[model samples]
Target: KGISADVINIHTIKPLDAEAIIKSVKKTGCVVTAEEHNFLGGLGESVARTLAENNPAPQEFVATQDTFGESGTPEQLFEKYGLNSEAILKAAEKVIKRK
Candidate 1:
């Protein structure tokens, strides 16, 4: 659990900061993308493509799988869908191992 990670806040998905992503990957040698959206065509996919083209590295995604949504409090929903900090830490650990 003594791993250091770079957190890039990608505000705009359309204009994804590919350069920043690549830079972080170059330094960390791995990546974990955490998003509230579905895992398929979201930030994870975009970052994956960016890494595949620029610098390939082990990656993990902490996003909700493609499934029907359920109504709940934001905390409950995040916990259920693995969109919480614990999930992100687990993903980071997994990806670091791959490196």
Candidate 2:
């Protein structure tokens, strides 16, 4: 309950801030990337590739699975895709254990 975290938002994908990502992971020893899109080719993959090339560490992804979205309220969509705070907390816990 007393863990420290740093959040970084990558606005664009073509030129991902790998340096910043690596630096943060270097200090924290792990990472979790949450995005609205699928994890396959989304932020998770970018972070994973960056870490794999540079400072490798355990990472978790809180993104939508490989499935199509259905029409619903924003809250419902977020909850269904596991794109909420609870998912982030769970992912953080898992990644920390790996670290």
* TM-score of candidate 1 relative to the true fold: 0.96
Considering summed lDDT, which 10 consecutive residues are worst modelled in model 1?
A: 1-10
Collision count of model 2: 0
Q: Judge candidate 2 at residue 94 and give its lDDT.
A: 90
Which residue pairs show backbone clashes in model 2? Answer: none
Runs in model 1 lying further than 4 Å from the true structure: none
Error of 2 at 98 (Å): 0.4
